[model samples]
Target chain A: MSYHSVVMVKQVPDTANISGQVMKPDGTVNRSKLPTVFNPEDKVALELALQLRDRYGGTVRVVTMGPLKASDLLRDCLYMGADEAFLISDRRFAGADTLATSYVLAAALRKLQPFDIVFAGRQAIDGDTAQVGPQTAEKLGLPQITYAEGILDAAGPKIRIRRKIDQGFEVLEGTLPLLVTVVKDAAAPRPCRAKRVMAFKNARTLLELEKMAEANSLLYVDQLKEEYVSKGLFIETMTADDLDVDLARCGLAGSPTKVHKIDSVILGANEHETIPANKEGMYALIDKLMDDHIFG
Target chain B: MNEKKQQVWVFVEQRDGQPADVSLELLSKGRKLAENLRGELKAVLIGHDVGDLAKELFRYGASEVLLADHPSLRHYNTLPYSRIVSELVDQHQPRIVLFGASFVGRDLAPRVASHTQSGLTADCTDLQIADVTYLRKDYAELLLQIRPAFGGNIIATIICPDSPVQMATVREGVMEKIPLAEPVAGHIAPIPYTPEDCDELVRIIERHREENKVDLKAAPIIVSGGYGMGNFQNFQILYDLAHLIGGEVAGTRAAVDAGFIDHNRQVGQTGVTVRPKLYIACGISGAIQHRAGMQDANKIIAINSDPDAPIFGICHYRIVGDVMEVIPMLIDAYKHKLK
Candidate 1:
């Protein structure tokens, strides 16, 4: 028996590279200034989905909600062996917090029905909120296992998962139509194959095709989209209207969280007593630390 | 719900019929917030036969305990717990809800918030109540959910302006719990919960627990190594030192990634946030990601060959030497002193 798995991925700004200019004075992120990358943990989630499909003989569909440029990440997913990729993009879906984002994703998932499993990264590096997957599961009325480290078995409608807890792990058995938020260490993500990368290199979303036609005066958008679709290179794109999502629950209007302030914290130790790199200095340092009850 | 009788609720998490430390910590913080808002601090507990823990909650500053006792809830399952908590929130519109940023809380809070359409902030370092104005609308007594973002380089203060119940999950060890004092008279409100037919989809088959490990959150001293430890074999020295000092050995994300340590032993933004009494960094260069997790330690000492290591910047004492060389000497000196 085959299984159908949907993996939710996101293109987040590389927070590790964030600098002073990345944060604007208005308490909003300067997205253009930060380089965008496929969120690291989402890749692991996709890897887990691909592994399940490889063993179970089904399909893996990767879905992401972001700007049109997120098509870049969709192509990466395709290159990494995703059977199908969908880009849920719309200006109306902008400025969404985790709640609104999950709402839109739940709506989109409902549109793509009859899925057996859904996978998402534990948390995004940018927002660092491990909320969306569970929230989406709640919205879809599905069982979710977060902090999933490994899939012990998946056969038919039953799936056993090894999930991480505070100090240990628990083996959980759940039915199909389940969502699992995978940790980064769950599995090592497979690299893009040379053949798949070349084959999916020209993949373009409908929005990207429109931009291509707009830039090239001779190329027709419809003709290019048709050609790409025929070549299995056109990434499926959806909008809020296409998904029939509630306008009120689609974006900033639906989000309850509002950023009140942003502060740049520069941590420093004004004064530190440096000990010499010798035996006597080591003894003295140990004495000082002991005096402070740092060690006995 | 009347404005004057509003309550602040804390999800009192438990394991093996004992209240988790983070639960007590949240109750303590929830009490202060409840006092500030002029409301009662209520602890919402869901478990099997956890009625006796209500007194413990009262001692920790909870004015009342709302408990839902059931055998199905003896173990933490997401669906039933979320449903009960969501129903409780809907029945009684608490102004603010707090949860410990434990595994159970992280999984349950968002589900409840989604069901009730309330906003939730995750892994908050601090919580306060203040007036907030957003988009020309002013909200008084909003929960200021402060958390580190951008890998601890920036702090963002969030407010739930639209939701009636503001929810937050606070990181463990970031807040101190009130001391266990003389038991105070408090009310226990029993919440009768019966699971729906389809609520039990996931079942725990077996639990594997690591034995004889110090919980980094509760560890008074953490002897942690970083990428500078060089190899997996070098971690043995750290274990030895930790054993000698009666502490636990933890590592940076790099060390974990290098396969020198397990993820549970990792201490960083992506790992566990630890606030021990003393944190010793060995060969850790101290990225902001690592600093965000342990900068709250009461005392920090760094051992790095590179004098310019950022770990030294935030540490109280700096030893400009190789950890491999320094740790051995310290261990020897300590052993001699003890003898």
Candidate 2:
């Protein structure tokens, strides 16, 4: 059977450059203050999926569940030769931790059926939680191979992958329909082919189409959407109506965790003690560390 | 409801038929945690004819050593190793699984955690049991794992809320390895292995080891050169100092950008986080990213001409002299001592 892979991608506000002014009084990030980029790892994942498609002769679908601003990454995915792309944008997907985010992504993955592989980045740079991929795999009930370094070999049904470990790497062969999380060193992503980029430049999600229609009168929103859909340039924008999503468990209502506070703390050494390389000296060092609450 | 007492599992990582040092480190930590919770500390040893390691593990603190020895297991393969680990974890539930945050730990922990439906926290600098008695009742309570967050600005204590086993991959030097003066006597229980246990199909064409770069993670004395070493040529000075000190030369994000060192040598938020005994910061302004990587070092001495450099903020001793001047002086002082 041919392989069909769907790579989940995300566009997150660049958290590395977050300043005091980046967070407004409302607790939401001021998007204008900070730039947004396609998550670096997710891009690596997309490349790995595309490579699989290139090697095995299959379709690579790119999916993103984010706000309308996320359509930019989806179009870029199309520019990079993804066979299909979907934008899961609704008010419900906002403010999701790894758990709730996995719920939404898994729901979306279920809607896009018939895939032998699902590739995801090891973790998002912003959150650095690295929980979403494994959680999604768990939800899908598929075998997962994370931190995969290279696709060693592949035959019918079973695919062999060389995975990186602490000291060295290990090779593993698993049956198809596997979920693999690619690392940054796995593969460098290919640049978008110029032809595809030009073709998909006009791709728009439903929300973007609606905004365009509101801004101009020459074209109707439906007319523009249908035109792009025929050219395979329109992102299949889905909402709560598209999937069998539990309304309660879909968004912030489903999210039970809340960030109470955020602070930048600086740690300085309170006391200094040096010990000799003897048993007695070692005990003294241990005692000091325990007294400082650094060790117990 | 009292939390169910879970057993502790240690991965006995062996390379070339010998056990790794980190395995002993995990056994030491595992022993303490297991003792505190009144749980069995089990060591999972997988290799060819490595049954002898079981006795060593016990000396360090392992109560039981689960040895899986097979010809296919001679070389570490993620497929077989993860399969065995996942199976062992499934058969005998481990409340906590500890791995040395070495390269292997970084790779294997994620795969095993995902397979067992457990949560894994990677590259933790600290591990502690926070309220063990109360948590035994909750299956989802994560053993509090703490690591530096936001470029060493704060220490974030993380827990895996739902996974039964709270797992963390700790950096090598972050935890002290317990050294026993004499090997304590212990017994080994051999875990059976079969051909089916080995599933890797990738054939190795070549195994060429690169010239050993100073593994910053393993290095005790890390001499890190930053942007202040004005040109790429200045990095050589750092190499000289590092060679004399019998350590590795590390670089801040700025120096890495200047093409002073390879990507693996980078120390920062996006780079490798190292906790060395003595981290000498030469000629680099301490960016948050740069500081995050090396802030865990035991003794930080910042050598910069500018007194107000951020490196001075975290350093134990701030040398307000130029790196070019100070590095030469130190090098001369050491040379004189040797003479």
Candidate 3:
């Protein structure tokens, strides 16, 4: 039997390239000011899902919850060999923490049923909360394996996984219909193929098509969407209303955790004695460290 | 039931019938929070034959131990454990809950919090109870969950104002486990649980635990290399030094990402946070991310060519030189001194 794997991906602001304007006065990050990229660990999760689909004959579908602009990441997934992509975006889903985000993702997963496996990144760099994957699994009544390093076997109804624990690694045998949050070092994500990139470059979500139609007044949104759908280039779109999500449990209102304060912490050593790069300085430093029992 | 009177619960995680160190640490921290809020500190123990472990919690400052011993609870299966914990939280309506940010705790805490519709903050470095004014109203006792964010560049304080239970997972090694003072008089409350007849969703057919070569968290000394080590061959110097000093060799994420060291050896936010007695940074330009994991070490000695590398700023002693030259001098000096 072919295995169907759903990979949850997110378009996160590249926190590595944060600027002074990245943080607002209110303690929340100004995500709009930063350039967004596909979350790094999520790409690794997609790579694992693609490898699973390659070994077993099935399809790899990517699902993401973000704004309409997240369609860019969905297209990138297609270029990297995802068979199907779904963008779950809604205005009501804005300002969602892990809880609300997982609630929406779980509802979307229910809509995309009959999946044998689910993959998610260990954590998103922006939020740094690794709760969505396990929280989604809990909501869906499925078992979860977090910090998965590699998959050993997945041919049968069960999958053997090597997962990272506290200090070392543990090989766990988990059954099918499981959610596995992949670690960053699980596998190197394969580069997007040029041919696939060219083929799916025009893939557009329904919202994007409407925007395109609006930009070009002569073009009809319905005709453009129909053409894209017929060409298998339309990324499926789901909103809060489409998912029948509880309005109270969709966004900022649903999120219970609030950021009380954020401080820009610039770390520095106030009084460090700088030893010269000469042998005398090095010897003196060593003598001091040894005297202090730091070298013992 | 007065929700305010509910006790602060710490999920006592165990492995091989021994209580995890983080569990004891949380019990200590939970005791303080309970005292601040004028409530009792409770430990939730879930495992077969964990009755003895319940008493151990009392020694660490748990006033009440809620035991959910069952055959299915022998191993940490998410479904059964989370279901039981969620049920307990719903019934008891704990004001706050704490978990160790271990592998099992990280997986289980969020699941339990989600099931109970509670707010959870993961990998909190510090937890405190303080009063705050929000929207012109006073919150008398809010748990200030403090944690490093943005790759350790900033600290974010989070509060769960809406949820009945404020849950958080504290990182291991961040908190010190208090010594067993005079054992406080505590009671063990056993909760009866029966495994459901439903088929097991995920079954652990086999578990192969790797032989740990290095326990960085418990290491007394760590000689860690970074990208400045230049190449994979350079890491040998660190290993040699650590071997000489009865320490372990660790690396920064840059060194690990560059394939100079294994991911397990990575010492940073994504890897393991260590608080060794001594941490020697060789050729590492310490970023905040790297420092976040090791800054808690008692003493840090940094050797970097760049006089202005961030590592020097955090290290207790700074030697501005090529690590290649400095490490050799250290190894030679230490070897001769030992003789």
Residues A1-296, model 1: lDDT tens digits: 78899999999889766666876775456768999899988999999999988998889999999998899999999999999999999999998988999999999999888899999999998888899999999999999999999999987788999998867889999988999999888999999999999999999998789988999999999999889989999899999879978899979889998888887665555577887767777788778877887766
How far does residue A102 in candidate 1 sit from its true spot (Å)?
0.2
**Chain B TM-score for each model?**
0.89, 0.81, 0.92
Badly placed stretches (over 4 Å) of model 3 are A16-33, A155-157, A167-175, B1-4, B210-213, B268-272, B333-339
DockQ, model 3, C-alpha based:
0.56
Docking class of 2: incorrect
- Please give, for residues A112-223, the per-residue lDDT of candidate 3 as tens digits: 9989999999989776778999999989988888999999987578888888776566777777789999999899999999999999999999888999999999999999
Error of 2 at B332 (Å): 6.8
Candidate 3 lDDT over residue span B1-339, tens digit each: 455565899999877577887788888888889989989899999999989889878798788899999877887777888888989999999899999888889899999988988899988878999998766778878999988786555788899887889999986666778956688899999999887743266666655555557678889999999988999997798888888888999999789878899877888765678989889999888766677789888888889888877787788778877888888887776666665
i-RMSD of all predictions: 3.1, 9.6, 3.0
How do all the candidates rank in terms of lDDT, highest first? 1, 3, 2
Tens digit of per-residue lDDT, candidate 2, span B12-70: 78767667766777788877788767767788888887776667787787767888889
**On DockQ, who's better, 2 or 3?**
3
Candidate 3, pairs of clashing residues: none
